[model samples]
Target: MDKKINIYKDVEALSEGFTSLLKEELSKREIVNVSLSGGSTPKALFNYWVANCKESIDWNRIAFFWGDERCVRPTDEMSNFGMTKSLLFDKIPTIDKKKIHRIHGENESKEEVQWYTSIMDKYLPKENGLPVFDIMMLGMGDDGHTVSIFPHQIDLWNAEADCVTAQHPETGMERISLTGRLVNNSRNIVFLVTGKNKAEKVKQIIEEREKFADIYPAAKVNPVNGKLFWMLDEGAASLL
Candidate 1:
């Protein structure tokens, strides 16, 4: 994996930098397939995009997908699709509806997993017999998990299926997540992380790799034949 670390002053600066990267990337191709992450920081990014770049961006040229989504109705507050829909999609009414491919959280976990897997296989470009997204965005939990692969269920990272059914460690809520193999196959994988609470795990993943391996799922995000980027704020990069 070719990796780069970008530390910003705060979430505000991080969002701005991410917006620039997104624009530069979208300009590189006619249709860019980007997998999204759900979280407060991403919420910030959406708001920034809406407030600053909505009119400037060529929304139709991008296809949107999610990295993971909780098993809940699209209207549910816990739903990743719901949050993204409200924050981004709702504001961009002209965006082509056919380009928005979401994992239906309302369906059964196993069923939705198969549904999303087929969607990826149909839409994403393939290389080495695996789906290859143009860009994959991920978030890191304080517990060092990325996507829905919690530390306790780390083996799911290598599940043969490109997408799998996952359960939250404590809540036990069902979720659909792209397995590590799928995420690692992307052309560009970026981790957008912030907050002081994540400093320890960030330190462990970046500086104490030998001791941290096999423990944190976030530490396992290595892009095969691709580039990896860490877009962090000062708080998350403090320990580094």
Candidate 2:
């Protein structure tokens, strides 16, 4: 059974709720490992954490991981790890570099994928022979996709692997993403969605979770042993 599912009206409200939840998890577990997603909403929340909730995080005891990443150099501005560093790591003295497990997009993509998957397999909780992430943060695109799994990409949706590299149909850029199996095995999954453009799909996801499961990639997010929480602003929740 899931724990708690919630939605917020604004970023502040969402951040407040997330912060408290994170602290509670940290209090129970000495070492908290989290899988973070990229994009505008998360970038904003990362900045907010650095500026406001830095003290609330037990940085040294927390390990960072990415749910997905654009295949780009770490020094590239588009790198998810880079964004997190600029927004939070550099601002806080509580966390150590070694604690952050980044997806090496600049290296051989296949090798990097295998390496990271092994790391998760070795560290995360296991059930039915699959790694179970403690927490995973996700975002939805205007097209109703989440993480790097775009529409019409049947391989990504049904992948049984832990991780894989995929080509974005439109952008033609490569992406490294956790497979649905891994995502669905998490203990907690949070969707931080914003923007008016996402309202339609957000409504579709929340209302027709099973009906649209095939077309809307966002609807496929089913953490086997986790709670799925959606945090959205007014614009994103308008249709919901």
| C-alpha lDDT values of all predictions | 0.90, 0.83
Question: Distance (Å) between predicted and true CA of 54, model 1?
Answer: 1.0
59-170 in candidate 1: lDDT tens per residue? 9988999999999999999998899899999998767889999999999888888889999999988987999998899999999999989999999998999998889999
Clashing pairs in 1: none
> Per-residue lDDT of 1-240 in model 2, one digit per residue for the tens?
353446677887888777777887888887888899889888888878887877767789888898888899988999999998888889998897887889998888899889999888777768768886677888988887787888868468788678888878798899998888887877778888888899899888888888888987888987776788887888898886
Scored against the true structure, residue 8 in model 1 reaches a CA lDDT of: 99
Q: Please state every model's RMSD to the true fold in angstroms.
A: 1.0, 1.5
Error at 14, model 2, angstroms: 1.3
Candidate 1 minimal-lDDT segment of 10 residues: 204-213
Any residue pairs clashing in model 2, and if so which? none
Best by lDDT: 1
C-alpha RMSD between model 2 and the true structure: 1.5
Residue 63 displacement (Å), model 1: 0.4
